[model samples]
Target chain A: MSSILKKFLMALTGLALVGFLIAHLGGNLYLFLGRDHFDGYAKKLEEMGPLLILAEIVLAGLFLTHLFMALKLTGENQTARGAQGYADNSKNQSTPASRWMWITGLFVMMFLVVHIKMFKFGEREKPITAKGEEIIKAFNGEEAAKQFARESGEHGSLYGLVQKEFKRPAVVGFYVVLMLVLGAHLSHGIASAFQSLGVLRPGWLQCLKPWCVALAWLIALGFALLPVCTFFGIGIN
Target chain B: MNFTLNVWRQKNANDQGRFETYQAKNISPEASFLEMLDVVNNELEAEGKEPIAFDHDCREGICGACGMMISGRAHGPRAATTTCQLYMRNFQDGETLTLEPWRAKAFPLVRDLVVDRSAFDRIIQAGGFISVNTGNAADANALPVPKDNAELAMDAAACIGCGACVAACKNASAMLFVSAKVSHLALLPQGDAERVRRTLNMVKTMDEAGFGNCSNTGACEAECPKSISISNIARLNREYARAKLLS
Candidate 1:
């Protein structure tokens, strides 16, 4: 693709990913509402099997589009030669936004692979417990009464798996870090996507960078807080 | 005062280069960095040795003729200043200063501290001008540009075709240089006749020439003697968008 077209694809894919994050965060926040509500939400999503597949396909397409554009541009940037000397326009223009694109994009891609393996493909099916005794053993410190306190009536569902995962501090911490990286990536990616697409105008664009970064943090934090809160037995009921 | 210099020396573009150290004694603190180099060069010349070759035309910084990486910085420690404008006072006595030509694939080393940056010229040639034939232009008053646009154009036009933007960039991308040209010409009515075509062709040439993509880090602006804003990059994006869509 042409550089401009590639840039546009990057912008569009980035925007799509941001949109997905907002929706995903919203769904994940149902955990705060109550266990029954959250489990039902998960069940509904799982039931939309074909639709979820379609969403996944769309996401994959976007990722491929964004990745290809970056690769093409990176290649093109490698060959040109130019006249020597200090041009007035070039001094001290480097920014973090420009330098870390490939690094962060690659990091995010790596994270996404693991993220999909763990969350999307693995967890989508019925809760795959090694054994009931293993769950009980993992929760060994707590008696059966305490372990069953939240699950009470519902144990073999998505909510039970979530409660189990959150009970592990390591799992909660892992997600918190992941969310932070996601937030940082989204922060830079959002406004830049607009600029790439030609929708962003000067004068008005300044306000968008901070706002986008903040919104990204908020979304990531929203997803992260529940895992942490639930693990600590603070917000989970 | 005494200082140590780790200067990169190469006979030509194909020659293997390495850092050669030279210790200076009784150096004046008032001398500019280039002047300090001159003292060293004069000593080398006296000793019947080849003087270190670097590019420098106007010692007054406007020429954009001198840019070297000093201790990992494009133009030394000073912010928004070129090497020509740098003075020796910023350095402490006995400090070691490492100088090298801008290290990027696009910039081929021609000799010690001098790299061929002709890639920038190719990008300009691709489409960095307003095509107006001599003695055929309309009255300047015929075009009433917004005050802000005119000022911004002048700001972009301030670029002196220096490769400092390429040097300062981590990717060695020349987007800042190319964008300034695209934005400056596109800003005026006389240039509007080919704005879309100009932006597209120049940027296409820039990419074809192997300049890395712009990450918008603003390091180029910080190192620029002219203090050119990264805003010109945004304008370039706008121009590219229009050119892509309308043309």
Candidate 2:
């Protein structure tokens, strides 16, 4: 395929992922409303059953397509630059974020793997309610966990898992750092995606540039907030 | 002003290039960058050595022939100025300058500080012109071109095909150069006849020439001697998409 078409696919998938990030951050922010509200939201998503699986499939498709195009283009670009580079080449106008997009993108992908493993396939203990803990202390094994969840009138405790994970300083620190990397990636990616799609005019880009950066940080900080707040005992009680 | 020059000296495409330092002694600050190089070349020739080889033409910055990486900047440190137009006064008296040719897979080195930029000519030949019958120029104002379009076309047409955009880009992408050519013609009525074919053919030729894809870093615009806006790139993208959809 042509280079333009490759870039066009990259832009479309990237924008779609940005949309997913916005929605994911919105849903995750329910954690601030305390355990019930947050767990209830998780339960609602779980209740979607096959539809949720289908959504996950589509989201995965978008992410993989974006990743594929990024790798393909980066390799081609490197080859096109030739083997003998300039001895003292310096950047005139390209930003650090723009130049190091492939690095940041790769970091984000690694973070996603660890993130999904930690949250989606992580431990699902009994809810941390007083009665639930009492039941857990009173009994043992998976039956007691299910009994406690049923008695507490709650689904599996995603909120409890989130609190457990964020309480770790290492986990919180990892999340905060990766969130910043994500912000850096989006800083260039958002505006670049629009430019690639040819939807944004040059005049509009002057104003849109800052907004794109702001939106990038906004989403990153929003996702980072949950871990930091949970670690500081803000939403834990 | 005396300056230290560390210039890339490549005998040919197969030669492994290396930097050789030469002292430019007692040069006038009023001379253009090319003139300073000429002085150094003259000194070398006087010393029974082959003078440094570079490219130049009109020497007025309009021909797009003279260009080099001066101290890591395409066309030196001046914005919107070509090397031929960049005066020596911009640098410190004792400053050390490094000069290198435009390095890209599509641009092979021919000699010291001179690379073959005929890839650009090939791209132009692909579709950078309008196809009209052989005749006298059309009467002025015969085909009504909007004022905004005419001005924008003129702005895009200001591109001199200097290859500075390629020199400056991290990917060495020529999107800016190709876009300027594509936009200049695509924006006019005469170019309207082959607009679709022109955009497709030019972009295809650019890709086939081993130019990297543009990542919208804006480096090309920053270093462009003509101050060609990346808006032309955006227009090129739009034109390509429109043509693709229609075709």
Candidate 3:
């Protein structure tokens, strides 16, 4: 794809990921409302049928597009530098934002895999239970639930599995650390995506920085707290 | 005050390098980073040991000639400053300092901390100039460029050809440098004629030279002595697209 198209894809996918985060956090925050509440909410999502399937497909596409564009841009950047190292003379021309991007991006990607496995895949592997009871998840209908269950297991307790998994202190700690890294990555990435897309002006960029930072910290902390709270038995109040 | 220095040492470009620790005694807070290095070099010279060989041209901030990684940071602890302009006062006297050459696929070591950065010169040669011949253009003000465009172009032009961007960059990409040069000239009417050729050729040259792609990191701007804006890279992207599509 063209450079500009690649950049646009980068931004678009980034925005999609951000949207997913917001939704994911919203569902997760239900954890604070008590187990049955979260279980009920998850059950409703399960009932969404084709709509939920569509969203997952779209979400997967967005992730793939973003990753592909990032890899392409990185490859082009490597081509620009060629075989020689930049002279000391060019040192003054580099920026930490541009320099640390790939490293942070790689870390973020790794974190994403772990995150998806911990939550999405892990949810599939286990079943959802509220205070140790089978939650009636909506997710389309019994047929769709059966489909997911057949795919996952004879009877899927995704939510219960989520709770059990988060109950481990070590796992919770790892999740918290990864969340911090995600926050750092987004702290630069969000603003950077805007800059790359030409939508950010200097003055506005300055003004938006604190808010962006606040948002990143909130999401990271919010996700991180879920596992920690689960481990500590501090479920909602 | 005294400080511990971990400096990369190599006999030559072909030699394997190692870190050598040295002590700097009675260092002054007011000394520039290069000046501090000068003291160390002087001591080595006095001791009949070969002094560390590094590159430096204008000690002033204007020359993009001097740069080295300090404590894993391009141009030391300061932001938006060059090594020649970085003052020792910014550093703690007793702290240990790690110094090394800029590491990139394109820039290879010539000696201890000097790398051959001529790849940059090659990229520039590919298309860093306008094709206007024999001063055949209209009067200087005749083009009547927008004031904002002119200012932005100049801001991009402030890039001193220093490779701090490359060193600070994890991939060691030269997009910032290539983009700045392209944006600066492409914004002006005098450079309009060769704009398409310039972008395509320069980008091709940059790619052929082994530089990494731009990943939208701001590290280059942070370490830039001239404080060249990363916004220029975005502009170059637009220009490159236009060149590729329109031409």
DockQ of each: 0.31, 0.70, 0.25
lDDT measured at residue B237 in model 2 versus the true structure, 0 to 100: 83
Mark the regions of model 1 whose C-alpha exceeds 4 Å error after superposition: A71-98, A123-156, A198-206, B134-142
Indicate the docking level reached by candidate 2: medium
Question: What's the lDDT for residue A111 in model 3?
Answer: 78
lDDT, candidate 2, B109-212, per-residue tens: 99999999999999999999977763687788877999999989999999999999998888889999999999899888888889999889989999999999
**Candidate 1's DockQ:** 0.31
How does the DockQ of candidate 2 come out? 0.70
Query: For model 2, what is the C-alpha lDDT against the true structure?
Result: 0.90
Model 2, retained fraction of real contacts? 0.70
Per-residue alpha-carbon lDDT of candidate 1 for residues B1-247, written as tens digits (9 for 90 to 100): 7889888888987676778898777788888878888899999999999999988898887888888888767788887677878888889878988887887677788899988878888887877876666355658766589998899889888888768777777667777788788878888876888888888888887767666766555677776767676677777777777787798
Write the candidate numbers in order of decreasing DockQ: 2, 1, 3
Cα error, residue B227 of model 1, in Å, equals 1.8
Best TM-score goes to which candidate?
2
Identify the CAPRI category of the predicted complex in candidate 1.
acceptable
lDDT of 1 at A109: 82
Model 3 Cα shift for residue B43 (angstroms): 5.7
Question: Which candidate's lDDT is highest?
Answer: 2
| Model 2 lDDT tens row, A1-237 | 888888899999999999999999999988888878988899899999999999999999999999998999999999888998888866567898999999999999999999999999997645556666666666764675755555574445888788789999999999999999999999999999888888777697787989999999999999988899999987654
